[model samples]
Target: MGRFLLAIGAPPDRASDMWKRFEESGAMRLAVELEGVQLWSSVDLPLSIEPGGSRMILGQVRSRSLGDDDHPSGILPQHEQWPSWPKLIEAFWGPWLGIEYKHRSLRLELVRSADIEMPCYYALAAGGIYAASDADLLVAAGACTGEIDRAALASALVYPAHRPSSTVLAGITELEPGRRLEWTPGRLRGHALWNPWDFALPPAQIHDLQIAAETVRDAVLIAVRGCSAGQRVILGMSGGLDSSIVAAALRATGAQWSGVTTVSAEPAGDERYYARCVAEHLQVQLAEVPDNIERIDLRQCHAAHLPRPNSRSFSQSADKSMLEIAAASGAKAYLHGGGGDNVFAMLDSVRPVLDRALDTSGWAASQTVCDIARMTGRSVVDVALRAGRLALRHGRDAPRIGNSAFLSQSVLETAEFPHHPWLDTPPGARPGKVLHVNWLIGIQNFLEGHAGQGDLPYRAPLMAQPVIEACLRVPTWMWCTGGRNRAVARLAFEAMLPAQIMTRSAKGTPTSFLYDILEAKRDEAREMLLEGNLASLGCLDRDKVEAALGAVQRLMSGDVLALMRLIDTESWIRARIARQRD
Candidate 1:
């Protein structure tokens, strides 16, 4: 990936002057200001830049493209100068420049995709406007002083699905997903660039199974067309519907493919037999990794990737390692069945409301909020009541993404904030709508941000804008008309995928390796927790942390959710310390 930085508000004539400013501060090169936009480019890793005299620091990083046969170097070329500001802006945004500009005051011209591939962070202080692509670099520019925000920490501890806008530290606000913040002079405005409510399922859009199949096929083709022609694409096939369909999609595109199945020696995690069947059916090479949880190095892992105390012990280190393995094995791009669950409308189970007096008008066909609360030991009644209230408020006949259990507690708490002062609804009214909102948020904020930092390009064919738009137009009954899950997308994909893949039901959850991995590293896990590497940060509950780790040491099987939370907490704590040092 390449890094580009721009500092506006500085005098255009000070080319050499800006150069020295950057050089003295170890910034890669001199800064250039043109047409009210100053810019700099760097190919170095661990990118760092000094504060400029201007209030704007716009950084654009181009990650390795999935397909770039035209560019022999496997990198997207950066034109030294654009013909006009609009062209340069379009280059950064791709297809997003057409969206309405609500937060225009930030005076910053932002044009990233709905999925945030290249993330930008800004902090207004006495020092002027400060922005950076990396959180560490933003801190280095004196934007945030390595402090954690307590509310953000609480949200993280409570929900593992998404990250909130405000971090653990007070003053440092994160740009939420699907949100664009523009700050200029005395005003700052952040607007939701996308809302699932804006997109509706069209009535009787696709009854013809053939039409659905072709649509799915077309979506898959469009998703992979940008990949490097011969790059081996990696699929996380689990013999489940999502990955299986994806595998079939790759085969249809004539793309060379390989599959990785994380198998447990026991029956529980081993989807290998089914996975093998699907792989063979699709004629793709597959590899199996026996992830023995009993012998994993949990403590060492904690020491390396996680330093905070963890109540969850075992984890499959294989998932992390497999990416590098796949890359080394000649795969330049990886595609997974991520976003399949949301697309498929795979409501886990429906709960019958006890309140016979209440009309179903206030609720979606699926009781998502209630189901979620039940699964997580939360108050189901309260969640359901909120959903009912939301349906009544929006006056929209359709079930929105914001009305689900996962959205209110997991997705929104983790990824978004309590903004959007424009509307009024029950606390839980927009359960489905919130999730749809986060779909945009995840694309515009999280996915791209993470990928950019890691120097890898990530694409989700399932979450492609066109695919989402089509699925939204589909009727709920048509969604698996034959009683199949993910009916809409599955039906859409029928022509592109094998019948075996299109009809699969069982799915794999990554948490299956949770307990096994923790047990293997029990001792190391205890040491890391007791050592208090992360306790120095006042934002955590040390007593609770110790107890959690101790409980995890006693587990034999797996608790995937707890395990993920442990890793997330530890990583966050460590990142806080590292950022503080910066």
Candidate 2:
């Protein structure tokens, strides 16, 4: 994996020290100085650097046709025929991020597709701006104070939602996906360069499921071909429709790919049977990594400097084992079906169908209401009443889902959690469009943060730009026909997947392992939360937290999830403190 640190507008002397600090963090293996910016990276990145222009392009690019018509239709020119310098930007596709330099200014841009992840965190320091791919590097360089942002912490603990462009540290900001930040002599401006919603087409414009399926299949194949060409690929097979489809696509391309799955001793948490079925159907070699909860080491479960809220404590060893196996197998990329549910398995809400039908005609609306009634096994009158109620309350704030009762009153009072932007979108907007936008943002944030954590490229073909656009253009009714989620996708891959695998609805839950982990480490967890920085900083009410921890065995699943979040927060804060002391 490649990481970068850039210091712009700093004095020449200060820039040198900043570079040294970055190197000392043990994260950077190479350092280079441009006009007014210093770039440091751990890997010798594939960067097309223009020293004179102070511009650099990191990662590979696939050629795109500009449709000049002077050239062959729909065919990309050879790399030799590509344009040079800034002009090359227009034809650039694939997983790439860029940094452009102007007169006393630096601009950093994350790719539109959010593949080849490069997360940038920035803070003002020493009369200049410093940004790094790692937040810990910025803190080490003295660009940020390292104080936890209480509001952000509260939001994470209480809302289960991450603020779009904010980090846990005060004054340190992360650049959102598909956004650019330009830092001039003494000012910085952030701009959104792409919006997935803009690609969404009205339902009236889409009429064929087969064409949609073909478009999606072609996009996935292209993405897999581009990413896994001439490389050993490993697929994380979950035996679900998403991963099964990806496996089938990889097989269709005649690529060298294998499947790996993590299985648990607990039957409830094990999916090895389903995984085996998919592997057998696809005719791929399968490797199983047994995640025995008894072998989990509590010390190794602690967060390191950075917080990974979505990660589970029991899966760390299994994750490391998978990475090691991939490395040993000479794998260049690991393909998994991330974001498949968000893009394809839309919610089966009646509101969207009702809205679309009403916009068309009364007969259409009544028919839709009847379909919904049949699908939901509710009376037509009841379905229509519920749809009307939903329509009336559209675009209004709903209740937050996370457990905030355990938070300290002071923290709750002072924290400013902004309402989700999607909730305020125009009421007349298609319900599917609104939901798609919400899921896109959440999934993009997740993939950018967690994917590609190790050296091997973790590619999600399902999240490819073309595939997401195609899925969005599909009507909502198709997604959840007959009250089945991801109906379109199921129909699309019916022939490639087994009936059992395609129609399987029961998802494996890791609750048994989670509860076991908590039980095994309950005492340590209690002490950590009670005496850790979270309590010391007044982010949590000690009494309530103690009670909750004491009642873990009796708590519901939702409460357990909330407690896990608290534990993660406490662990992260403790790690930050230890690093600061070091």
Candidate 3:
């Protein structure tokens, strides 16, 4: 719900013109200009300027003992007097972006938790360092070039779940989480301020599960209550353990909340029964938005400014319907359990357990083997042998890049697609750390870049840093007990959630509905991809695209997701090209 543009080295006149262009784009509801930075934001953002100072803070900050001192304005005085600004910034919890100015030097900081969700993109253009929350805005303001970054585009196609720090525009780089960028005189520097991995501790060090569960519950309640304070909030209830836990926590706080869920006609895609169960248990009115696959429109779903195509296109109509209901209900913010799976419920992976066993004691290894045997219904000998093989095979490896049939050979050879760093990390380092980072980056990017475009502020209480850190402290064995994924979370809320929801193992799949939408709009997609801007740019092969369309017409089911990704990429490329020309 907030957007900002900052130019560090540009002349005053050029900065003013860029500000004017952004203001005219209808993207910002308020505009502010300081010595060198110009900030534009939506009305919902809690933007505060320091009294008689060039420092400003945007978004809400939450603390346990701070009381009203948690507000950014109240905390600014302490930060100003502190010797180390980065250390002070790192100690707080909340979603926020901060800007500080002194003696003509400008510094921009993105909170380590990335809960406030501000994507910063910068490039050396027009004789200055220009940065903005929106990448397209930087290009449109003539502060960044319009030329596409081929590597970034390829990365999107290959690794859709990973959020690359670099953007699709050449020479433009996104500020990574827990990082800061500063510009002064003729020099600019960027550095990392914090790393969550540094705080991770071995799960065995924390012996008590009850204490952990209580701590996690407290964190969730604090986050939910803190973010939804004095506001009408919408809870996205899916009847799953994650959403249900959030609903139960909100109900415990006695906050003003309503439930909204998307229901599909396809039984495989429907979860209304469970949703209704949760809503009834909470005694809250639930609004259902029927996702009729026939209403899919590629253009309507296309988010032109995003770095890549996302699930927004797949759920565009359904989300719009849900948003309409939320807006009509007078909600100020929409809350959901986005990162619950990544944080609380980690997937069952034996590699990390085996890796830890090999590096540590044999007693620990035996315990893990016994746990695996119990969970997988396999013999101890079999589990131990398998674990040994996995441990021996464990090493750094490059990510598996999927081959796109449509991408031009020349582009593929020349583009330096950035590799995912986690792919090279040691397996025994810490369980769920890599997955947590992936979810944080991916979800934050989607929410800020695409979902925040809605009328109300979109919030995720389950994604709070405190909750995530608490979950990370949980051992891998506890997460997947008895062959169940997210076992810890299920056990934590056993008394709060209904038996059906708390024990439900299977999740509803939307693949069928997605394919149906693609088939429903076959003709339009064909024309768009066959002669689309992406094909003209040599990013895709026209012949292969036509073949894919033919397969879709025949109801074939080979890599349909990849085909959809191609369509999304082409749609975004066409829209971006149009914007550049404008």
Candidate 4:
């Protein structure tokens, strides 16, 4: 919810010059430069910053926080916590450092937790290394070459949305989620901590659903206990299982809560009935904001609040509408049902996992392989063998077939590469044996993607670490549909939820307004796609670009997805260009 920028290599005397670039940008909150590695935090809060040799560090200490006196960790011990930050820096930097700190005993270079919880960016350049919280701030520091990366462009154009940290700009790599990088002279060191092996199952244990659900409910309640008393907590009620579960958890916590929904007013997309059911179940008040763009003047607001690349799910008009509701709601934090799909369903990335899960005969495995082969435009049996090889390479015991093409890729990438400290598995464990591990991967991916973005403190009780750890330990019959087929979440929700809410389907599906944006503004959308400053950004495949846009035009009028894909691509490209110009 806050942005901070730190730049090393400036002379102690001219530190003010470096601070000016980030502080004056309006995007940052408080920008400070200090001598001997400054540690700055509210005196009452346990959080702080300090110096370790040449690098700076930041972190928080567990103590009673000032915001909520009832909270056990009341306030951070600033000076003491400062030393702990350097210990974190060392984790990212590895060895080769003489340590220094603002606080002597705490040792910022060598003490404390691994959760740095700070949004930071860094780049290695000829002069030295530069670090900041925002990508734009990095550009302003003169460390960036101002050239867009073509690979990122290809990813955005071909994939659904631009993945986090992987922007459409060239030579500019984001520190991947859960990872950090350090620079010293001619070297750069990096490390990621979100390992799935951390949550690996014991040799003879299986999780129980009833007990696991209660444990999940408890963790969510514990999180709610930290909320400031007398504050109204907001839930982004989508009438879906994830959000409903979160709302129920808040109710169970006995906290003051409210529900908010952004209804597109396009047919049945309005979540009033399900949201009301949730509210009534919790006995809480509900507020509904129709997705009406004309009611709020987007043009004026965009200029006033967002003069750069502002990407919204729908048109700028819908963006303005949502902002208005948030402002009016007086809610500081919102709970979301965001990660249910990744954890519950096989999702779009099932094929790879399926290829690894099946125990079919050589002939059947060959057929499965052929299916994958044909999908990728290769020979059937040959592709089947290739699929088996890929499964073996990824350490899957059996391969599942007929899963979603996109999600299958996710499983392949995630299974192949370890992202968390806990994701480490035995060398020969088959893919089918690691369903719980895959669930953890999906959870990590969700947190890194959604919770890390925008202005909301989007909480996911269902994806809570303990929830997923427990889910993985339970039977696969409760989570996957086709051994990887479909509707795993739907079945589980039905068992736990009220019948009306349980039977309801559809979540976050953009309604008719999305198609309306295209139908009413096709010319405008085309102009932005073809003639806007974004088109000339030079990193995207011009042919793929044209093909996607042309496809958008020929698609059915109600295909909100196609329209969104087109607009998101355009917006991403436009934002990159705008950032470059800035």
Candidate 5:
């Protein structure tokens, strides 16, 4: 991913002077300078400028329309195509950031697409707007006040995956994905380019699992082909259906690629059986890296340089091993089936049954209830009763943005947890659809990180826009059809997959490895949490934290997960402070 730093509306003098600052310490080189805009990019990707500069695109990008070539982040769509800004911006993908200069009403409006596939952040500081693909880049450039947003950090401990658009730094705000940010002289506003709810509603719903299968099948292929972009692809194979589909797509594109599966010491985390199946079936090279529990250092913060803490102790080995393989093989990015479960609506609640009953006649929906039963391993009577209650409520209620009372009452009382932008639903929205949209929210963190050039950045083609939109358009119940979760996805690629993968139901996870991290590093975790930076900032409850870690115990009551988040966040705070000192 090409790194970029953009300053919009800065004073002429500051814009000119910032060059020395970047040259001295920043990660990007100066790329563009307009009347009020100055852009810096890591790579000198050619600037796509409109004649005489009425419109322009700076930095590298890959579009759905042109996946084979990655450049020329599109010119603004004609009036006939997109009537809004976010819609105009949403077509591009990647943490590789870009800024489009579009002229409107004699005013220059530059909108950065920060949703779904791309990561963008903006802060109005020193009487101007500063934006960057990496948040720490902006901080390093002195574009932000550098004051930590403590409440935001506290909220992250409670809800890491769906943290609000605001960043931990007080002055910077992350641009929400699938939305547009509008900046005028002294004010800012937001507009959504698109949303999952649009397809979940009645008008866009598709009942045919067959059509849904075909749609996702094609979209994933296009996404993977485009993402491969002639670079040697490295597949993080888990031997699960999701990663298998990624392998199938790579084979279809005839791209140069290989696979790696992380094998855990414990049997539960071992999926080499299935990983072998995929590599042999497709006739591609495969590697197995040990998920070495001993390698996890609770103290090492590899992502400490990032704007937020992304390092989970258990993922450290897998991440490091992948990087080694990438360096050895000359791969720039790692592809996985990251969002397949969420996109395919593999949820635990009876929400799908509720949605099916509401969308189909009773006789037509009866079979779906049976399917839900088998898919979730619950009885038909229980599933129907839960779905019936959900229908009576017309699907308005929602679970809390996050759940964990790990924080002190003082923190919880004043925290003001943020709601997801999409949660503010329109009237008559289905409860199941709301939950479906939320499931998408849950997997977002998996797709993001500080993707440095040296790092083998993670890519999720299954979570691509067209692929997600296709899955969203299908009726939620359809995923649970045939007594299996993600049934549509299974059917979509059944012809391409080995029979074993097509029928495998037990997906692998690293929960056991995570527990191992906590157990092995119990003292380290206790010391970090009991007297760490977060407690000093009033983000953690010392008593509760001490009690949780004070005992050497099993992973119970989600306490271990909560404690790990605190440890991760604390490490990050220390790293951020240390960076400031440097």
Candidate 6:
């Protein structure tokens, strides 16, 4: 959540000069290099060292560690700067960007937490690589060319979750979640810090519901407490199991926190009843902000400054309200249950049934079929028959997120590629787990940066690395226990949440809100897209897009969502064009 710039694999002079180059812009004031390590960061206590220094440790990271109020801002305690300090962060866990460097050697390693998404980018510069947590800084420092990357933009438009490394900015690479890069002069090595496949396909999978529940509970608490330390947190609560569970953790942490829920005028978008129940149960003050679409600036494009257009038109109202609440109340962070569904294996498919049959014996498998049948409203025979068919004949059956019909076939045939490295698992891998991992891939863009929320750090604790790992280890079938999706998670917070929230089957959606936005901004969106880069760049088909927008009233909810995504992307593209013209 801190803005930083670093020079890796550069000669000493060039590496040392980066501080002067970026900082002289008055953007990065003071907080310069760590003497031996050339990292200049805005985070005061950004580095952590274990007391024993025995093995490279992740728990020792001050900001990410639990119950540590002393350096809650994390790691900067004015200790003597070590020459090897940067290198020690090689295996650094959690949602931080760590760069390992040797003082004068060509040896350098850059690592970041896969727990939550932070915008980090690196561009190969003259004789070295210049990296930064903010893409603008890299572009300003001449590390990035400042030119837009239309090819990457094409992939993002068709499928936003297309790839991890490629960013909307061309020539710049995003250090993806749970991944690391090691540079050794001639060759650069990069690999995943953690793999969901390992958790899904293994004897390591958590089969016991009790154990899985306990593990999830612990991980959630750690993720919450670590981020909540020394900070007043404003939680985005939706009376849903995920946010309610987060509320429970906030209660346990004894931190200064409050729950804020956005009330939608549309019935489908409203979840106040559940939010109120949880707040009353937790005995916390709840602030309900009504979603006001009239308040949204149709002409304003939030992704104007972002590396990509990731923000939605809906959040323009909700996030504005939350930003005001957090600012007025002196809160330093925002927490939400954004990725709970995916992390908890909330799938609509029969993969859970298939997964259950794979590991369980006759009675357990039979019970699972019944449970899945009840959850999905399918007959037991149908569930069993489907599971049998999937198990018997499959190369890799993990469902993939397909491109929308609005996209051009040329873009589909030519630009299509494997969206994520983790998506392609080894042969015989469980499609259920692959499907679960796919959920994680799809939700990556939801990890919004602090910049969008008035500089207050945004925390998605449920999506944190430890919590993700714990849930990934959980057997896919375990989520459907007692015929409930995410039953393990429900079990984890059974005591803290209200009974109604624990058992509620329905969840809110912005389908109506999407329709509302389209109706309200239909003309604006039409002019924007018809004249924007998406159609001109050959990313989306013009006639199809025109039909989706022109017939907004008659279009389905999914089509509306798709159109909104294109508008947001087109808005970003137009903003970039205007900036260049300026």
What lDDT tens digits, residue by residue, belong to model 4 across residues 124-161? 55445555444655565555654555444344433332
Badly placed stretches (over 4 Å) of model 5 are 44-47, 58-108, 450-454, 550-553
Q: Estimated TM-score per prediction? A: 0.67, 0.86, 0.87, 0.67, 0.91, 0.90
Q: How much does candidate 3 score in TM-score?
A: 0.87
Candidate 2 residue lDDT tens string, 34-147: 676667777644555544454465655553322223221112333334344334433344555567666433544332224424456688887777777666767766787677
Q: Which residue pairs clash in candidate 5?
A: 115-177
What is the per-residue lDDT of model 3 for residues 366-462, given as tens digits with 9 covering 90 to 100? Answer: 7667766766668889877866765576532323444555666765665565543333444445434444444444555455424335466667778
**C-alpha lDDT of candidate 5 relative to the true structure:** 0.72
lDDT of all the models against the reference? 0.47, 0.64, 0.64, 0.44, 0.72, 0.72
lDDT of 5 by residue, 258-374 (tens): 999998877889999999988999999999999886777777766664566665655778887888899899987888888888888887777777677678777767787899888
- The residue pairs in collision within model 2 are none
Where is model 2 more than 4 Å wrong at Cα?
Answer: 21-31, 50-54, 62-93, 104-113, 201-205, 294-311, 358-383, 396-402, 419-428, 444-452, 541-544
Sort all candidates by TM-score, best to worst: 5, 6, 3, 2, 4, 1
After aligning candidate 1 to the native by TM-score, how far in Å is the CA of 323 from where it should be?
4.2
**Model 6 root mean square deviation, Cα atoms:** 3.7
TM-score of model number 5:
0.91
Clashing pairs in 3: 95-116
Model 1's alpha-carbon lDDT is 0.47
Which ten-residue region of model 4 has the weakest summed lDDT? 298-307
| Model 4 CA deviation exceeding 4 Å by range | 11-14, 22-46, 49-118, 160-167, 180-182, 200-205, 223-231, 293-310, 315-322, 345-475, 480-497, 503-508, 533-563
lDDT of 1 by residue, 414-506 (tens): 532333222222233233333333333333222232211243444565665444554544433334345465666776656655576666666
Question: Lowest-lDDT window of 10 residues in candidate 5?
Answer: 74-83
